[model samples]
Target: MFAAIIAAGVCSCYYDSEEGLYPSISSTCDTTNVTYSGKVVPIFANNCLSCHSNARAASSGGSVALENFADVSAQAASISAAINQTGPLSPMPKNGSKLKACLITTFDIWVRNGKPNN
Candidate 1:
């Protein structure tokens, strides 16, 4: 019975934080080229577009469209807070693992750089 219980516990899926999975990601992350078109967009494309895209926002992403420069720039402050899982904003990638530290840092830098459209 103990063996069976242990097996079940070990096999069950649990939420994995980035720190638990890839501690090295923070040190190696390249935060120097965080452009709206290049770095920021790709992050949203991978992690957010399914819900936050213009076409799907109404149905799934609370109408928060991040597919364009104006919308994203407008929401940049909240985006930073949400990704860091802090402030009044809800932690993002909602119901999923936290974003890697590097990605969070990159996004924060973009937001701090005046959220430029470039």
Candidate 2:
């Protein structure tokens, strides 16, 4: 009876789906209408601006400026690589955690969409 009870208890443990375990990992990331001002800038503001903004670029950002649209646009590929923590470039947020996959996907979509300022 004791052995049966223990086996039943062990078997009763619930298994969580990946999505349930990580609710933030969305299966469908809406990348349509991604724009520099609306999407890209906010991502930079939240993550890169601290070190890569114009004011701080020369000091802590290794001279990389991500505050303005022009600079951001020019370095879009590098930025993507860095944030995605891929390729030869250093992973961004530099010493911090990588950006969420959705955010990276959004950036890639923005880049693909000709990198509009809107």
Q: Which candidate number has the best lDDT?
A: 2
TM-score of each: 0.75, 0.75
Q: Using alpha carbons, what is the TM-score of model 1?
A: 0.75
Q: Where in model 2 is the C-alpha error above 4 Å?
A: 1-28
Candidate 1 per-residue C-alpha lDDT over 44-112 given as tens digits, one digit per residue, 9 for 90 to 100:
999998999999999999989989989888888888888889788878988888988888877877876
Worst 10 residues of 2 by lDDT: 14-23
Q: Superposing all C-alpha atoms, what RMSD in Å does each candidate have to the true structure?
A: 10.6, 9.9
Ten-residue segment with the worst summed lDDT in candidate 1?
Answer: 13-22
On a 0 to 100 scale, what is the lDDT of residue 4 in model 2?
Answer: 100
**What is the lDDT, from 0 to 100, of the residue 112 in candidate 2?**
70
Q: Please give the lDDT score for candidate 1.
A: 0.82
